[model samples]
Target: MSERITLGKTFKPHWVWAIAFGSAIGWGSFVLPVEWMDRAGPMGVIIGLWIGGLILSLVGLSTGFLVKAYPITGGAFTYAYLAFGRKHAFLCGWFLILGYAAIVALNASAFALMIKFLVPDVVKVGLLYRIAGWDVYFVEVLIASAVLVLFAWLNIRGADATAQTQFYFCVLLIAAATGVTAAMSFAPETSFGNLLPLYKPGIPSWSAIAAIVAISPWAYVGFDTVPQAAEEFNFSPAKATFLILAALVVAASHYSIMILATGLAMPWLDLVDLREIWGTGWAVQQVLGTAGLAALAIALCMGIFTGLIGFYISCSRLMFAMGRAKALPAVFCRLHGKHGTPWASIVFVCAICLLAPWFGRSVLLWIVDMSAVGISIAFIYYCAVAYRLFKWTPTQRAPAFCKETAPGKKLIALAGMLCSIGLLGLLLVPGSPAFLETPAWIALGCWVLIGLGFYLTLAREYCNTPKAEMDRLILGHAAA
Candidate 1:
């Protein structure tokens, strides 16, 4: 087996937390509340977020345990490799790569969309061909492409630069969110009356709540990024585990606060009819005028930028891990000598981001929804791996987070697996509220087929190798 090229350890403890938090929150904090409330009602969304958080916390515990046991770059892929083997690990990595790449593309499209909202003419300046009912603009595509290149360049500069940028952006995101929440709370327009009816007249409350819960994984998706960079964290394995949980708590709190503030600021019925409700920003503007909106927009733009950066960090690392395993082209595993960064992988992701805007906003959204399904599938595998690890591994070699061999720990893992399975089923089953449209489902199916092709080719090449040699080749000696 060839020696694996490893990523540098440049992410400090705080930076680890920042990446996880920033990635988890994203633009969803600002935009999702309106839709969440629309579907689930104000109180229903809050309760749904809380329930979702609790369920994800169990998944986080499993992830933390695995990170401590094997602090490697692949995150879920590494765990799956150890628990199952090469073929299963490749499948896990393939799905996760799709999930992370889809998010990066989603953020790129969002950056263009947000700019269109703030300055409408830029998107219309130079018209491009339309796609899927939405107009494609040349300038909008240019902006998205430029932003993608800028962030990809930053990542290629090295992990230290990426970590520092993430830390600063996260701080700005938190401060801006706090300021908006405070302003909304004090405004006379903000009233609990807006939250009076917990559900819409015709919609069943249970269905509404279930809808939010079904998409909850999207809200907490980035927490696993911490584990993706485990080998690059400049800290103890235990601290890395703590950082993952801390990021989840921070992200959940941020989502809940934003949703509550948006609800208090305006009546649900008033905003329900509009295609998009500016929500918190509009509420603040009603009281404080243009200045408040300006502040909120700046904060939101910052949030979007941070999200793009966070996901770039994650997807690049995933590609790097897969490349080292020979499941992908080895070019992806090569580091820039001076920068100590995965230049090829970062560039590959940026190229995808650059092309995403041409598909238009509606198509991009479908991709994002499909990505959620991919993430849920990966989570189910993660939970199963955690259960097997805890049940069979010796205490001395088990993750530090798992204090003792107990039935309760095993149960948590089981619950996480079952919950993830239920969520995946909700997304895939026809007629479920969470079921994606035909096109999105088709896109996801095509992506999986491509991954399978890659797996078959790689498996054939390694077929003649001994089992031990194959394990070393696929899992990497560093992880073992």
Candidate 2:
């Protein structure tokens, strides 16, 4: 917790944007694009994604405002502390821990699934007991473990190295995706006609779109990672909002393009019914053959790699920030001396990820899918902070902490809050299109119990500490 031990400030604007975009676009765009199309047809998916993106933009706006105001590492954790206090900050950070670390593990797990598809039974050796129907393989577990170690090492090397690497990987991932998209558009075997029935039959069109929109909380999760790195930026914090907004725009477009590419490659209706574990990959391979497969393989690897690296940067930073404030073990604040990185926090995340593949992919999917509820909770905190801090009467000037309180800012914050509530309802309310399944509910219950145990321990330890000390550690010079 020494002030001298800090994360290195080496991230540039594009590097920050890369971390946001890459983290957001990872494994899902490749594996789930066709699933999204099947649930909600091509147009339905795109429109739903944009609508989600637009709403997430409002959350991003409030998040960015606070990023500039606090200019710190913990993102929502620190934001909640500034706006509320210790209990609320811990509430925000605990859920965020599940959401962020689960994604890093998801990306690692995805690498195994990708290889299994490409090699076909080569790595499916040594069948382990099935959990939730996903056959856990010894070789697959090792593959995922290797990915976890690789990215963990990269993050331990420091933010500058990790962020720059993520930027390059982002370039490769987007280029490969665009290449396949162009190839699909011009291929003699494909046509726009295949994209008909833009909305899935059987479900009402609005319901179909709602299904996609409901998951937008998960879809656009990465853009918020930008704020976690605010303390490590070499550039002015004023640019943080635009950088996050731009990354979100690209993320939405990337998702839309992938969905379109999947539909364009084959008849959407027929392709969805085809028995394939990865419909998007299968569609691309069918249309472009080996070349498409190779390009897409590159995209998948880069996407997963970038995701692992980006989230490693964000998740570890969150722990480091929390530890610095004694919300977590103070050991998490320790950094690698030579690299000036949060090595302890990175290792903690690595340890969690290493054990994840053993649980098998199905359980991981249930856990990861339920992660949306956690992130939506974060969105509620951020916008609620914005609404409370910025909604002063027009005749009165806004507080010093609020740099920009444009007209209707209050309404925008309210809309963002309602949108977040609506998303939570979709996931938590029974019979909603995106309601949590039984397994996901069980997973969420476990996480809540675990977090409660930790929080009570921290509370007992910090109960006697003065509020001013907590403020100084969490907000630094930004403490009011």
Candidate 3:
């Protein structure tokens, strides 16, 4: 109800690219390529990513247009509210929070996993109970907990702090990637022959490529973070829209190069035989020795750190938006007096991160797989909102850059909706490459039930209030 609770304008134009690109290229960039290569090979990885990128690009286009019109903090949730209603918005925000929280947990677990590789004894310091085949250690959990608190503090300090950190990490990641690509290109040991076998043995071509496509949403998840922080961006809507597109392009290029460089550095069969899940690092060590491997580790750490920061920013803002709308408690909407950051939401995200370590590293993959489904669900809502917004009367529509691009925007919205539906089908259909396991489905169901409980209990009071009174109490604006 107060102006003080609103998010401040602090993010610059470049930070848009940094946050989105940095988030998209997180832990997955470091570890998933081997799986991608194993499924399809270097060419398959490239082609699959390009295909997935094209689909997500449509979703991105719809997101860009919607953000330009609404320019709100909630991203998909806000769009859903405008097009559908509060209930649909709540469900959309609920699933998105699950996806964002899961990602935050995944990155925290990855940081621990990476540290275990870099300094194997750190996890051995405090022997904790093992769950799902991962040996949980007190020290490993402590380190992850510490990282969560540190990132939360940085975000609580201000959006500028988060953006600055994202920018630096992204730059370092790009520089390291470029160095690796250049080094591998000229290295005597590097050979195109290593990439000779383009597909894994016994796997059908379409199935292999489809496997990569199934995971595509996880690879390009960060671009939507731009819209999550739209209110904080210090730029025109059109510039913000272009930044989203540019970030996707940059992310796609970085992923392609990284996959290619890793393949060039070593024989795929040797990489498979090494049994190193961190194949990218192993490849760097093989090609450039320990020094290069150290650099690669640092770059990878930067990637994970940026991801934690970027997703924290997104999660906190979404919670803040939900709180401001009175879908959750007002405490979540309350901003820090001096810093103007969503302190409560940051702490809430930190709490979720603290719980993740107990599940161990193996569970992190399940979390990532589950998050892919949750994210796709949110995208479906976003596409639907885009479609509805495009059809709204001039007087009902918010100011947007859609005037000249109306037809294009409509097509993108339609395609995004269809593609998102198809993705969901891929995840749910039996025997589909992307189909999630039973445990993962159960976990997702539990999360959704928890969200439903919160909505039913906390949202009722706000729903019962008069529309005018509710707007004033929640948004500090008149009802539409």
TM for every model, in the order presented, reads 0.93, 0.96, 0.94
User: Candidate 3, residue 396: CA error in Å?
Assistant: 14
Residue 184 accuracy (lDDT) in model 1: 76
List the global CA lDDT of all models.
Answer: 0.79, 0.87, 0.81
- What ranking emerges by TM-score with the best candidate at the front? 2, 3, 1
The lDDT leader among the candidates is 2
lDDT of 3 at 241: 68
TM-score of 3: 0.94
By lDDT, the better pick of 2 and 3 is 2
Q: RMSD of candidate 1 to the true fold? A: 2.8
Q: What is the lDDT of residue 64 in candidate 1?
A: 80
| Residue 453 alpha-carbon offset, candidate 3, angstroms | 1.3
Off by over 4 Å in 2: 1-5, 394-406
Q: Write the per-residue lDDT of candidate 2 for residues 1-480, one digit (tens) a residue.
A: 346245667899999999999989889999887778888999999999999999999998878777776788999898887777788989999999899999999999889999999886788899988887788889999999999998898788767877888899999999999999989999999999999988998899899999999999888899999989998989899898898899899999999888878899878999988958778888888889988989998999998998888889889999999998888888899988888888999999999889899999889889877888899999999898777667446566655455454657777777888989898899988889999888998989999999988888887665546676776777775355
Q: Better model by TM-score, 1 or 2?
A: 2
